[model samples]
Target: MTLVLKAMALTCLVLLLLQNAPGVGAQMYPDFKLQQPQSSVVVIKGDTLTLNCTLSGSGPVGAVKWVKGSGSDNQTVYEQKGSFPRVMRAVSAPSNDFTIRISNVSLEDAGTYYCVKFRKGIVDDVVFRKGGGTEVSVHARPSVPVVSGPSHRAVPGQSVPFTCSAKEFSPRDIKVKWLKNSTLVRAEPPHITPELSNSSYRMSSTVQVKLSEDDVRSELTCKVQHRTLAAPLRKTYALHQALRVPPSVSVVAAPSGAVEVNKTVNFTCRVQGFYPGAVTVSWLENGTVMNAGSSTQPTETSRGLFELNDTVTVQAGEEKSGSRFTCLVVHEDQEPISGTGILRVTAPALGENNEGLIGDSSDILLSSPGLWLGLLLDKALLAVILFFLFKRILP
Candidate 1:
């Protein structure tokens, strides 16, 4: 009877202890619960972040704190003693709300966060409960794109290189493209590199273009696309900035072939297929600079090149016969290009009674031998008749 009573008392003490223990009481009451409503969150850089947490039930409770990461990599984010500068409790103390707010969040702040319940023990605080972690994903927008081209001017049929670059962006997923005059241009694949300084990424894209005369007014665009951008970013560069095409020069006379003396002649200088429309034209006579000629404004061609025409008028005089007329074209700080035309002059004919008549008779006699012999025979016959008449008259 004594052994039986001792065993029963020991079993009663064990039951009392189990009912008062925190972990056992939590399971027995079934009212203790912790909840993290958000399983994951995404926030942009420089924006505020909110981590939701709630506690309920009338079970044993203790101080609450927010912890980031897990295991050996864990770090205390917020607690009753102290917290980081950018981190704080969302609700005031003495309440069931254990939500947290982080202001001015950066890329470094991205991680999983947990709302933890801790109980004060004899030696140290012990973890009583933990809510499901909230995964934080921070995103950073890429910088504006910058476009560049070759330093020297490019000509038709030449290949030139152009570059477009962007930096300081998070997440390696990015796209870059090139365009000319709103049309897509084939280019090399984008080169992505890690920026160790800020733990971000940078990208560059290059394209090789075979130039044509039509590119003088063309525009090149660099377009960038990323997950953080609502619309693609674009930067434009004018092709004319690096294009240079020389003009083809020619000189033509109004009459074409040859012109008589004292005749009015028109000399035209044609400047075609040149870029950067600004040009000057001058005329020269026998290596001497003549008066400024009339020039038409540079006109744009179908191929986007420029053309101009300049005219100079002069009288063709006897002294100006065999004279040379030159057309000089100066375009875009380049040396002069020249084209030349020659003038031919002839004197007016004289009347029949003048020295011109005597020269014509001599030419006819020299050219017709049969006619000269007939005239000589007629003269000899007339002389013989005169001699016979003189002899008869004298006898």
Candidate 2:
């Protein structure tokens, strides 16, 4: 009887060991598994995130539930065949792939999550098994960078200070770089300031560089880098000179020499080497301003500097001899500068003979006989007027 009992006990022990064998349970029904056992996901704010938990061999599964938290304090974030949250949804059936999607993820959605498969036993018992899990981290990207300074203008060998700033980012892993004309600027030491706010970070970087004449036309750019961005963000500034200069003014008369009566001449006024091109050129005849023959546009000589030309036409007359012409240049916030020229007119002369000499000249020839006769007549009239004046004075 004792041998029979021992045989039965041994048989029972062998059956129990076979049931608890390592390969036996897997051969019959594999343990519940996930395609990716563990994962980590990082996303930016206002962006969508998807976590897929593909189930392998979870048999007799009732439903799939996504829980947020670790160990015992876990809370169901989403469950298949249940009321879904506005931002959370089950993308596929738990039996296939227990995938969940979170739309418009924000900082509040950052946490560890797990996919659990629920199975009901033959009685009133319930069993839970881990399918997969992931750690989700949601971050806010920094604001668009801003570049500012005390002045946009600087002189050669002067120190120019500039500040570049970004706000409201996460993870504290942002990089800032300064560039001049698309090339990296590393000579100047950068001053960086970072502040923490509600677990997020804000940053500001500053640089002071001594500028030379060669950097006058260079473009300075601030580049920012963060994990949330696919490419670095950039801001650019063009430098200027604060010291101002006035234009040089000069005038030239076309068709030089003494002009005859009823002849037109052009006086061109050139203004050069001026910055901030706000200048006006005016023609002056006998100290009076004339508004004729003006240019509509000024030419750019260099950056922020310009050159201009203005002309005036004048008709020569008998009374206009020895008349003075001036070109007055008016600049903004500066004293006016001017250049001057003179006009000379001469009348034709007459022959030495007392006989009346008459001739017509459609085109005035200065050496013609008619001009000499005209000049002699002018001299005789003057003598007669003077004699009358003297006779009246004697009486």
Candidate 3:
């Protein structure tokens, strides 16, 4: 009987404990949820980025502490509260009042971030901001870095600042990163600029890196990253005191510069020796234009290393002599130079020549109708002379 009474008392005690556990269930740290933006978008370098996060439920923010994995305790990246930023005790009025503002974010700032709430000895509510998640990207293009000492080569321990810039983009989710031999160079503050409002910016950076022979010998790339694209943009370049880029060109042929009648003989024009490479060639027959596909290009450049190629076949008895084939090179700030070659078409057969001569002789004979009139004038003069001589002899 005593054991039954003890068991009944233990059951009542267990029910009381369950009822008092409300604090553990109510004040529990809700799974920190972030709302507002469905996707994280990235853009080219030199663009601004803003991330807006919202709460699932409505309540006072109470106290909010924002922290980043990359930012150290001393260097607080972003804050919008009073003193003691480590503990931001602000009231979040509405669900829409939750947001984080990041300006001109860079690669170093790329990491997870958090928003949490805490009360003394009590587990208060918390909100969270996850990784930047590629919200911005920098489209870094291939460029030649500003080399102070020498662009060609530099020794180790030499302080060389590789300066490059990227233009702004939409949604502004771009990142610029420096690399040496495909390895990242770590440093404090990895210098970055702030995002501007209502306008895009051109972000420039001078990476003070130690230059070794390896940096001078081969190709280097200045890479730009952004969330807009699946791959990062890269600009490839080489450092050399001497510029090694060469000029290139193509050839064109003229219409009517073929083996048919009323067409001149074919010709070619070629231009070479340029840098950073943009070259075009054209064919000119007596200063007229010709395009490609008119003639086949040689596997190797012909003499004078012309930019274009043009040739015309001769038809039977086609007059092609005295026609000119010219090649021209096109470039900025440079006059187009042309080379000319002569063409000659053989004359027609002898019968055709005789017919042409007869037609010309008929025209000449008809033109001088006065020849018959001159003969009649001479006959009249002879009759008058004979009559006068007979009268003089009879007297």
Candidate 4:
């Protein structure tokens, strides 16, 4: 019975040794030292940042975890105690560098950040870190204002009204100024573009000035300043207007006939429809200005609407062919208007067996049988008369 008890004790010992063997054969874990992180504070609602953690000597880290410690239960930031919330990446070289990325940071995110590595249920290393902080200063985009003032280009003392405004982004106290050649112009009651964006933004500006062609031609600018934006804003436009003028020239053909060869015809051109109308009028034969043919007598229109003077009458023979006549008009602005009309000379007809005479001009008609019979009767009568004359003249 004692021998049986010894065998049972030996078996128990063997079982205990087998359980301890795996744990004892494990390699010794090398210790890691975490270098302290650089300290920094950031402004709120502003730039984003990343925290970098460095350490000395790398160990066989089963898992690297990130965590944030609070009073009660340590809140897990990137890793739970035994497992990694993320896979830890390491450089193949001997040095250790771990960087965490943070985006669009706010003030509340400020606190202690840590990076810890673990191996075989042993704590390898711990690193303390902090991301930059921010001071909350919220602002919005500024307003767009209207441009106004005297409607045209300003002269020396014309007091051209120049105006701009920002009605939208209000209560932000917008300031406006005028700029010329990139330099600010001093004037009473400056201007600016206000926050056109909703109340979320700040905006303001204004510009009122008296200017001229020189001022308008020079680069004109409206400057806006706001508390929120980093720099001033501006807008610009050219001052110009399109003006209208009166009517142009008039052309007419006289005697209104198709002039055949050797026929005489006439032409006339006068300045007609217009306002504060034409000051001078003349006709052009082809390109030659007909200044010699001026009529001093002015004829009033039957409608009596305007005074029509300077009738240019030209006597043209049929030899004048393919002649172009134009009436020229010069107005108050010395603005000139010209219009053209073509002259045509008729040509005579052409035919065979033709005579210079226009009547019965064909030889075929003169050679007809009826015409020959009439000619023979006349010849017979003339021959009888000649015989009678011989009879009388022989005695």
Q: Give the number of colliding residue pairs in candidate 1.
A: 0
Model 3, 99-130: lDDT tens digits are: 55554444444434554433332243322233
Question: Of the pair 3 and 4, which is ahead by lDDT?
Answer: 4
| Model 2 per-residue lDDT at 315 | 88
lDDT tens digits, residues 1-395, model 1? 99999999999788756655667756864777889988999888888999998889864556888999988789999887864898877889878898888999888988999998775554566666788899999887889999999998887899999999999888888999899988999997899999987768999999988888888889999999999899999999899887888899999989876676677988999999999888888899999999988889999998888999999998988899888999988877788988898887776656623764565677878888999999999999999999999999996
Estimate the TM-score of every prediction. 0.71, 0.56, 0.26, 0.30
Candidate number with the higher TM-score (2 or 3): 2
The candidate with the higher lDDT, 2 or 4, is 2
Best by lDDT: 1
Q: Sort by TM-score, best first: what order? A: 1, 2, 4, 3
The candidate with the higher TM-score, 3 or 4, is 4
- Cα-based lDDT for every prediction: 0.86, 0.72, 0.47, 0.52
* Candidate 2: stretches off by over 4 Å: 1-36, 52-63, 70-76, 81-91, 94-96, 116-133, 139-168, 186-218, 238-246, 252-267, 274-278, 283-293, 301-305, 313-395
Q: What is the TM-score (0 to 1) of candidate 1?
A: 0.71
- Candidate 4's C-alpha runs over 4 A off are 1-38, 41-48, 56-96, 102-177, 187-201, 222-235, 239-395
Which TM-score value belongs to model 3? 0.26
Candidate 3: lDDT over CA atoms? 0.47
